[model samples]
Target: MTAIEQGTAGGTLNATTARLDRLGDAVIVIAYIISVALYLRIMAQYMVGFFIPGGSPIWEPVIACASVALIIAIGIFRGFTGLDRLDRISLAAVLVLTTVLGAVLLIHDGTLVTSSTLRLPPPPPVGTLDALLILGGLVITVQGFETVRFLGDEYDAVTRVRASRVAQLVATSIYIGFVLVATPVMGLGTAAGPDSTLLNITARIAPWLALPLVISAVLSQFSAAIADTAAARGNLTGLSSWFSGPRPYLISGAAAIAIAATIPTLVLVTIASRAFAAYYAVEAVIAFRTTSGVLRKCGFALLAVLLLAITLFAQPAS
Candidate 1:
């Protein structure tokens, strides 16, 4: 979608199509901003949960506000490249940690037992619509790859395509492998909620792994949020003169902090998913019009309708 928009024949589409494309761009930019904020909120939760266990709810809000302030300040003074090195290092650490987490759980399969401190809850029966809603909500989990589309300035088209493919393959493999390996030990964690399950599971299998896991989680989230914020700013500034300065960053940061203080993480997850769904639905329409093959156009049309449904009906996990 981004490639089509940034193509050489810019705005050559009919005026109505061009208008819709711009509208999609605006939606995408806004959605990315919210996603960055939500990432910071989740990162703040990790910090509080690890460093100040059982801390007051007020602490998450305070930390989130401070984090956004730091992001905005660094963005204004140092630029997005300031954190490039750290982001790379943390991203590598995350990949390594995910590998180790899965391997360790697989190796310790025989020793795993039901949690004594926090019992795993039973799954409730879900109907078809409810299941679809949950699946839609989880679409955000498979994000980040699309961000590669916006990195054309840093990487050539071929490089971006390969990177996107490799990212999806690597991340999806890790997710699937981790899920398969950790199935037996799912009941071993002593978590207060879903967000802290990985940390608790880490502690259960290898006590020594807990601290590094938290550190990696913290760094990865912070760096990802940084990347998203920069992406949002770049897209917004490019789209309109009104967002050409620090206004985009400032406004989005404020909105994120406010949302962090008020909304539950689960709710934020669903909202973020819907926001991105809207963006994708719009992009699907753009693709539908631009492509040549009848079959391909039909596929895009179906995708647009499906994503539109998700945007409207997706629900957070129970």
Candidate 2:
């Protein structure tokens, strides 16, 4: 969707992101549902393990539920303005942490880099199911960037284009920088855990940075999830007027988060990442099938299959 929106000619179709059909929207909703579930669950766990120490264990549920609920309530009551506030808060945390960490890495560690694969249990033979699943998890790590596409034409065309470019560049740079510094300092083991990556690394190098980074991660995930939840909810309601009311969405959203948070989950990072990859594949297929030209349609269909194939080697999370 982002690729199409950003003027990437997809297959033979002059793909238009603006006129997404119901089916495309529905599949996109599923991708968001699973992605947000994985994000919320991991974030809640991070908070429980780090910030809310020495309290009655009951506090775990409260913290987790409250964090998810608080954002939902904000989204419902405050709408776009509330989301903006959440985005700002999260961004502030990100800016501060990135600046300090980048400076620290350069000064304290000097030039260094390490492969996250260093400490990994030897991955199953390449092309195995385990390897694919692991690679999927790695893909999920950078999935948040696609959320930018949702911003759409909210700004003037040129402004949106420039802004998106700048944002992606900044995001890629920071992520690469952080990984370079963090992998060398903490190794693959620290980041591969179920806990938040920032929380784990900061705990070692900058204890003082831990609290704010965790808060930032939790808030960021919650905010993004709520936004995704609302998108999913809108699609559901659109499917049938019988699914009307904010009540239904609120209940379902909470239930999904709770289930995702408490259950003995699988390789969620892998699951969510592949789900998005699948979502993209589906969109491409839709584009191919809908295109007016037979040649373009076949080209897109082939491209779609190729994209799906590449998921087999996406470089799994460590």
Candidate 3:
């Protein structure tokens, strides 16, 4: 073929590949949305008992087991998929969620007043458990870069660099903004409350916002689930390629998801939160080890320590 013709053909092939990769990423995003929706629905139904129903007994062990199982399932999946377009969508959702949360706090001006005349109990103390849950959620919310990294081979260098930068900037700004709002609105004391203070704060200030926020939370959770599931499937695909069969990996992925769904929703979320924290910690260590950069290493180390402390110490809402 002529040189010009060859170059044209190559360009077409690159475009085709990029399009396919994007399609696959979209599938993952859809799956994640489904998963999150399921989780939120379940949580909403049981929120009162799970948080603070007057006479209900706590089911900490069951909840914890479910949480661990869900996390393990997601970890296996995310680890398998690495980073991709779905991860980007998931990242965007997180950024948007954080922005809304920050806005809610800003609008409320750090106060926790409700329009209704019902008397509310004081906020809970900042026990280890509360700290862990908040910190863990924040860390996982920003861990989309890892997903991007996994899909690195599929994109050109320029695309990779641009995507990474955009994700980082958005993630950082939202997180910082959220912390600023959270600190004042749900004082450290109130933040430790059994209920999701963030959600409660929003509900109190504007009941209309609650339904939509719940919807968004559900969607975000589902997106995360899709990212996790796709990751698991991709990992299995890699393994199958090495061993010359896709069946094993396919069966494994299906089994994992099935097991996850059977577990209680609250348990799944808690476990997933803690496990993601640990996984991110390890991931940070790996990054540090490979780059040998002191600043990056320290930052990751700190994240790991913070997540671990939260997981081990966060007090369950009674």
Candidate 4:
């Protein structure tokens, strides 16, 4: 072939690859949406358990089983269709919601440390076990932002950079603020207890806001689940040419739902958060190694260490 012809062919091949990548990203976004919805539905049932006089039967394992079934069905469908431009838009929407929610909480709390009025005691020593659990949980919680990478194909280089910057700012501001506000409000001692810190914080500020906060929390959790499933499916798509077929995607989605349903809502959330954090830590290390400048490398390293340290040491409010 002539040189110009060869070059033209190469360009076309690259474009095709790029288009496929974008499709995969869209599928991931769809998976995220489904997972998030299921999570919220399950959580809503759990929350109702607290207020209902007899508590609801829907909070049981049976409900979880049903959820899993639904997830699998949805995952399969999304996998079959592949990714698309609309999926990218959905992913962006999720990011925006996450950012806004984080910003709102940070502004509402107005501090980084725990609040005193929430009946919390002093925090445990920095390196103590309880401290580590709290810190670890927070780190895991914040690391959820890495889901962005799964949608890389859906974003152009500039969009990726901007999204990363926005996500980081929002995640950091809210997480740090919560840790600060929660530490004092619930005290180090109470923060180490079993109550949901997010709900507790909202309740303290305004009892009336509690229901709405709980509902929003459910929605957020569901969103995270959907994103998680989408990411998993996307990875699978890359692995198996067969996955490009409809059946495999459906099966994968079903499996995700089944697994989700089997696990307790709280346990699932905790696990998902921790897994995300661990993944983020790895990404941070990779960033550190890849950056050409010493300053950039050091900054990433510092952030990674800080995240790890917090995961290992901070206490959660009771």
Candidate 5:
């Protein structure tokens, strides 16, 4: 009687776990679709800004056309290696320019201990949903490292794990360094919009920097968009054997165009943040279930709760 009771409880628990895993898988697929759409929208907007000096009359239509072209191009590409190389080159160029600008700013003032120029700004008030959302939106900035998990065909599990760790470390270092270098100029841009803010900031330091900034933006965004598209394709294929060849990419592209037509680019960004937060929350839950140590389980549970809050409450930037 005792053995039968134990077996019945174990079977029930296993059934519950399986159902949860299936739900998590569905959520992840939806998140990946959102990610692909957001990436394409961003890349299209940046490309339009780079090529067209003044804004076009039909802005969203122009973005849609550009996104369609980009989708086609990504479909034609055979692999990520070339795209990765180009992305690295563009990133290196931008880093060099940022470093140079920072060095120039420091040297311009003769007094190293200047009072007004070098002071860090006071921390902004954060006791509100708006502030929390703003900070949560930053999760997008640290996003690309997880792409390794979608590249199973190209890399083994061990290699993907190792690569993801290295990618996260490198990306975090770069983000921190870039922020530090640009701290002085952060407050300089007044009239610049989202797409041109970095360009305007760079122009203030050195007018010649604008050309490289635009080129870097174009290259890096395009590469990143392609990466996201590929990841979405892989995810869809994993989710369903029926999703193969160009079918998944086509569906993603259509969804992206529909989203671009309906949603503002800024709102699209917030939506992406919410999607990624939900995805990560599900992953955290899975991690909590799979891990053995109490500390690890507690940590994952805490992370899942925080991510779920971001998903539910994070708002679009004003």
Candidate 6:
């Protein structure tokens, strides 16, 4: 019998199964919390040093000011524009940045860095454990592409799917151009360790445009943060009646992030990222709870197992 059918009946086995399901959900929740804590750390170290008392990062204050102004604009405009409208505008900003980046590549003549310097040694054979460990992480580094699922509540599934598809296509085109451009320009080691890769690229190729790129990237990050916050709040609200509103998640999640900020970035991104991947795998299984038909259920069950393997075997992209 299906999960829904079991729920409809008053039977002995069903009650036990429900208890087990709750237990599994509880485990997943714990894993997700741990993963987020690590992710927050990564943001602090590699992404942006959120709290800067004072130093050489003069742009931090500029970005902060611009972010504040943008938030005010969002508040005034959101009711009229709605989330979908705002997302489209933000998406356009990202595309514009990509276009500018591409233009810089065209204008800059000659290779900036040698091909040999950028290349890494080949991995072990595919079936080998080492090869799997090395290769799997490359996939997990791009885990955020599925975040469109979170926006399902605000828009129709068809709309969300279309948006995600368009985003992927555009982003892929931009990324391909960027990789081709940046490969020859940036030395392999320097790009990997960048505090701000966008800023680094602009500085190297187009110094005059650095300020605009900085401001644009900051705004893009702001929009992404807004979307992720909404997703987290939505999930929390669905989790329990006690957390049935926005206020709880807003207050609690904010404080939790504040605490998470204290942790080291390396620890968070490397260790916690794997934990998130594992949770992503389990989430697939949970998604099948409402699915019908034995064959479809079996397929999803196998998919979950496959995801679980990837999650466990995958290494950190860094």
In terms of lDDT, the best-performing candidate is: 1
Best of the two (1, 6) by TM-score: 1
Q: TM-score order of candidates, best first?
A: 1, 5, 2, 6, 4, 3
- After the best TM-score superposition of candidate 3, give how far the Cα of residue 209 lies from its true spot, in angstroms: 1.5
Rank all candidate structures by their lDDT, best first, as comma-separated numbers: 1, 5, 2, 4, 6, 3
On residues 1-318, what C-alpha lDDT tens digit does candidate 6 reach at each position? 234234635453345445545544444444344444443333332234323322223343333333433433443345323544675677678668757766776555243333233433233345567666645544423444555654545676677678778878876776677766765444433534532354565665677766666545544555554454445444455557676534533443444354354444343444444555565566556556556788878887887786667666665434
In model 5, how large is the Cα lDDT of residue 289? 68
Alpha-carbon lDDT, every model: 0.76, 0.61, 0.48, 0.52, 0.65, 0.51
TM-score of 5: 0.79
Model 1 — which ten-residue stretch has the worst lDDT? 112-121
Over the stretch 151-211, how does candidate 1's per-residue lDDT look in tens digits?
A: 6567777787888899889888877887777665665544454333666667767888888
lDDT of 6 at 234: 48
Q: Compute the lDDT of residue 241 as modeled in candidate 1.
A: 90
RMSD of 5: 6.2
Q: Cα miss at 78, model 5 (Å)?
A: 3.4
TM-score, cand. 2? 0.70
lDDT of 2: 0.61
TM-score of 3: 0.52
Q: Which has the better TM-score: candidate 1, or candidate 3?
A: 1
Q: For candidate 1, what is the total of clashing residue pairs?
A: 0
Q: Which should have the higher lDDT, number 1 or number 2? A: 1
The C-alpha stretches of model 6 lying farther than 4 A from their native spots are: 1-88, 106-141, 188-198, 286-306, 309-318
Model 3: per-residue Cα lDDT over 104-210, one tens digit each = 66767534445432333454577666665555543334555544443434665567567778878876886677666655544423445633555666665666666
